[model samples]
Target: MPTDADDRVYYVISDLHVGGDEQLGEVEALPELLAFLERLERTDENAELIINGDAFGLWEITSVEGTDKFDYLTDTYPRLFEQLRTTGDDVTITLLPGNHDHELAAYDEYVDRFAAYNVTLVQDDSFTRRVGDRVVYFEHGHQQDPNNRIEDWGNPDASPLGYYYNTLVTSRAGQLSDRGRYNWLKDVQAVTPTERMPVWLLSKYFYREMNPLLRYALVPFLLLFNVSAVLAVLAGLSLADIWSTPVEEGTAFLGQFGAAGTALWFLLAVNVAIAGLLLLVGIPLYFLRRDVRKTIDRFGVFETTLTVDAEEPYEKAARERFAADEETAIYCYGHTHRPALSEVDGGVLVNSGTWLKRLHRRDGAIGVLPPVFYPSYQLCAVRIAAEADSVAVEFEEIRKPSPSTEELTLTERLLTLGRKPDPELPDRAEIPNGRSATPPEPAE
Candidate 1:
């Protein structure tokens, strides 16, 4: 199916977890990424580079500042922009926000700071691009996480603590636990079954308990933890079965207590037990709940869809002015970290694979399973090529240098101390809507 025309249009990388611990030996991958950019600039003058999401770990920095961890990335970001600008001066650069760097919600700061580099920051998770004759939608795909249903962010009934826990602590913690390179003990500490279980159970109860009343309220907040727990559990099971060597029977039970003993041991154990129960109960509830059925109707089992009011006067005005169609265009998103491309009856659906690496290690006779580091790791990009007859699209990964054994050793040592550095923010004034003032240039 390869063609010369398809080769003419290329989509560059996005969601590079530059500062995260997953960068392991892949440090060399940075220059390779840059080189890839250089090659694109030289060979494909009309090519567009779209950084889909998680371009930076702003949220991670807020939680655990790892300057050195992100040092390579911070140093490279501005330069990356400058290089792109120099390459074509007219090349299109579109940046979307992922849960990791959702600063785009506050767009004014991003634009004012990065405007000189010609970067366009999108406001909402959803946007449309035109390639030839086709229209393509772009979103970070976090809304489908169930734990971060996106609708709950602005709901009136949601508590600030609930919102913060779901958006910041739980989601990020789950991600770290799922993708971090450390042993299973560290992963367990970062995200416990207890934390994930209650959130799942409560979310199910709240959604069913209140129905439409709490649809926007409790459901989103509760689902945040539920979804996270599911992912964490999946990751934990995979890690325990795969990379981890079997412990002596006595050590296995003791290890379940985790790092700390004392009263915390019993408390954690109880929480873990509760979480286990919730998962046991929640899995079935997920199948039985009417509200979940409704969710399934609106958004596919592993999908998310947002129906904006196109007929609204304000929306109409914007659509007309922006040359957008007035018809309600459905944008479907998913968080399975596996990129999907499909056409639905009325709109389009996309899956933005994770920015983390899916790393798996096999310890001789331990077992074989999905690597903790390997589940959703890949820097991917999608190009929507719309010609008059039909629309075609393709995805690609931007390969980078991986971490070496020595680097892993150093990372493990640093992580043991819980002293990762923070990412640097530009001194420019914050953007008003956390998006770029300029709309993204049309896809080529």
Candidate 2:
């Protein structure tokens, strides 16, 4: 059905990563997603639901063949697929391949298969649509990334660094965490800067694998060890007489001991202090030397910036790029997994963040062996419509009625310890890719 009217609506979202793995299938916000779809169906009948990329997560598949992923996805989430089918009846469903699901572009059958469900599969690298007399660019935005960008964009056999990362790190986490007390492995994909993955993996081991009593016992010692390290440094300075009063002023203090005895006393005191520190901190450091070193190496300057909570550089770049193109008034894409909407120059850029759980660390809270996965939902979708003179873009965080944490499994509740307070969004959206311009729907 072709619409000749200039006033059009585009409903965009990305990085659904449905059937991400057995564990991802469990924690996915399917209810919220279905609700979002249903709401869209009721709002705009001719709207196009654009799933920009990484929709299926075929790269996370360990054993399934390329072509069988659709069936696997359908089998894993029957209700979700059914909702998609129903929603497709009301709105046009468009699928664009991202790096994780690049196989979709390589296999034409995927297009036909989705078409059977009233969904349209786009094999191109990007798609453009006209809205309000201006061209709007829609792309997955993966090519800009060094790790995920493929040399041969649409080739299925071409492997990018991201493919290996997913296979080795992501898929491995999937397999191991699937067996955990909670199906928490799906959050592995939420990590950014990617360096944090190993640290997160270590936390997962401590929480899920280690003996509870033994682990709790180590917590106190671990904290004491930090204090011990600080004390050791102070002992070194004390021995050097950095804080000492002049010998003339300290006559009473030294008068109690002979000249040589004074020097010996200070040395003995410093040595004893150092010895105590060695017992408290040095012993644990000796035992966990390899781990401590690995932690230091990971955090010691190179790629040290934890980009997870940081605003994505790609979003800024995309906004600038869109601003340069005069004809295009809007640029919409979604690889960063953080929803955003902003005006750049005469144009605007929108990023549809992932449907998966997002972990947000607080402003200044550092954690001790924190949970690998922080429980959060940044589930959202972008609604784009033509206005009188411009294209109106809105980022809406999808909300759903969730059960109490008591209903959550034991492991799920355990994963919430040391988590940051719920992140606060500002009232104004302001510029490109910040918080939403309008207030997001209140949490249910």
Candidate 3:
């Protein structure tokens, strides 16, 4: 850490993923972002805002290539560019390239263009910032990910697996999002762990795109699937004379309701029949899927876990950096979109999370419905600076209401009632002059 730079405060954020064609261009927190910049402009402290990586979604821009992507971004988001200019005038703003915006390093035009707007495009994969006597290493964190890692940092043709993902799926969704009954497909980026895409698509189709009549008609069967399965088992046991009493009692109990009793019996019978058929078919499909997965694994075709077990790689990387540079007190990054603050080898590790609407997977309270992706915002800026004799780190959450009412279906809301993401971040984390103790718990 540099001694002369001790007085300056640093604000870090990443994975804003701005700029794409059509629905991908929609930044739900645009107002919040502008307000954050405006607040920075009015601050009295000496501050530098470091966008660690992925300030733009250059990879998702199917409409343009190379420098034209920046032009498209500036044209599409004039207000954002204008705000960046305004904020840059007041606060030092710096940007580094992530996998999504690797083009920032590839094209030399981006440096001058970003400079015109007051953002210093670093054109590198990683860099270090100093706060007091401690150093914080900043990277996009994609280098740890096999699918997104770029072997050649500035090569224009170096496309990783993640590049194809954005191009084929995310960009395509953006272009066709409006064609859906609800513009839900645009949120494909919010679905973490790329493996969840198929399930997410199914959930969206059922809750948002499926015809209302068909959905409503099938709701009863889906909701009572478990009950039906249990009843089928009970029926089989009764036929075998192992559990005959319960069935007789249940039938007699319903028989007292006359016509309604008849209807109830009919529904139950249909449910049992459907359950039996499903069991027979699902058994074969389950084994088939297992076999396919095993074959794929054997061949090592798709060996990525996407977002699963996201922390280990970054944590290991952070520890390596700490070992390599003993002066380093913080390792800051964003890529997993999961914000965390934890002690690592006498130092602190920080993930700056994303400004994009986060999708928290919520399973059905009962039955076998597809997991509902509840939407919320964890928009935050990590501030690190000198506080007296110690180096201090604090998280500042940009408050935004969960878009549940607007984004979720009534069925989804009911199924996931009283359940929504409320992530906690340590209000303040500090490393003492000697770096001997663990940080305290978050403030109440």
Candidate 4:
């Protein structure tokens, strides 16, 4: 028997990444997350909660394997599971497997366990729903990504390259991140390129591990090092008495110059010494960076996405998928952890970014001195509802304010010092209805 629930408002969120061990604490916004579910109970009592994918971090499981994970997850996140059960009374809960938690699809026992809580486990590769006049297509979205696309899905032994990378790199980082005050570094798995890891890791060290005094001191030191070379050249010429070429026209040049020149030379000489010290340090540092890059390259990566300026692979695939069947006007997915809303194929495509705190280096501000990891949260849910003739997708950011939310990175502070203080407000954006057509594919 089939039932229709068109009036039901749909809510989708993904990438909670509840880790295998004690990593359940990684869900930073516990209060707000529970608040959101409670809101669902009060507002749309029978609304469906489709956790599009990556609900649990099976890849992060280090010790337990086989059906043991079922108990481990339930034990670790008893409160969360209990909340799900309570919420299931009003809202139908659904879980799908993303690349990180492909094991959910590997075993049928997982389905039975979830069934106890009245939660529906979507084992299919993709799911769809009708919204007003349009059909919305949903998937975990790793299929389009080669590294994460599992050819032999649903086999406990079968693992993708992404799974291995997470186990080796991400698990190691997450373990260390837990020691830091904020465990945002655990989510570093989302960042790509085998090379980016060292820089990103260094940024974490600067922010989380480094002594406050040393971290603050390094800023001015970096600035001074940049202009030190020019200062050194000036001092070298001044010391050679080039500025004191006994003026044949007048001794006035020497008399007034003598007083200022001595003072100036002293400062210049200091600059030369500092610059010399910097060069002593910088030369080795420059070589060290090169060595690190080479080492990471040698360690190798399974795949690196070569994303272009405007044409992201997921967006491209969405547009083509929509074009293939004119019925589907909306394509939504998770896994990118980037909240995106773009116009394509006469409809819209949206990404339900992850709940985990994301870290991106804001290199635009500083000219690349150990790129700063700006901690941010895309913590959001995509709401789909029937519109006049088509369906509309809205991104609702769920906030749990902490001191870290407003705190600026050292680099961000230095860059925006003179500018009018940023007018920080709640995360609310007036999204434009449409955008330029997806640019033509790069010429072959």
Best by TM-score: 3
Clash count (model 2, backbone only): 0
The digit string of per-residue lDDT tens for model 3 on 288-406 reads 99999999999977657654357888889988999999888899999988878888899998889999888888888887888899999889999988878788888998999989999
| Per-prediction TM-score | 0.46, 0.75, 0.92, 0.76
lDDT of 2: 0.67
**Per-residue accuracy of model 4 over 285-334 as CA lDDT, tens digit each:** 99999999888889864236432122377778887887787777777887
TM-score of 4: 0.76
For candidate 3, report its TM-score: 0.92
Whole-structure CA lDDT of model 4 = 0.68
Ranking by TM-score: 3, 4, 2, 1
Off by over 4 Å in 4: 23-25, 178-187, 190-195, 211-220, 230-311, 364-369, 402-444
* TM-score of model 2 (CA atoms): 0.75
Error of 1 at 409 (Å): 12
Residue 80 local lDDT, model 2? 73
lDDT of 1 by residue, 150-233 (tens): 564422233322235544553355455434233221121112212343443332233223355534464334434444444446
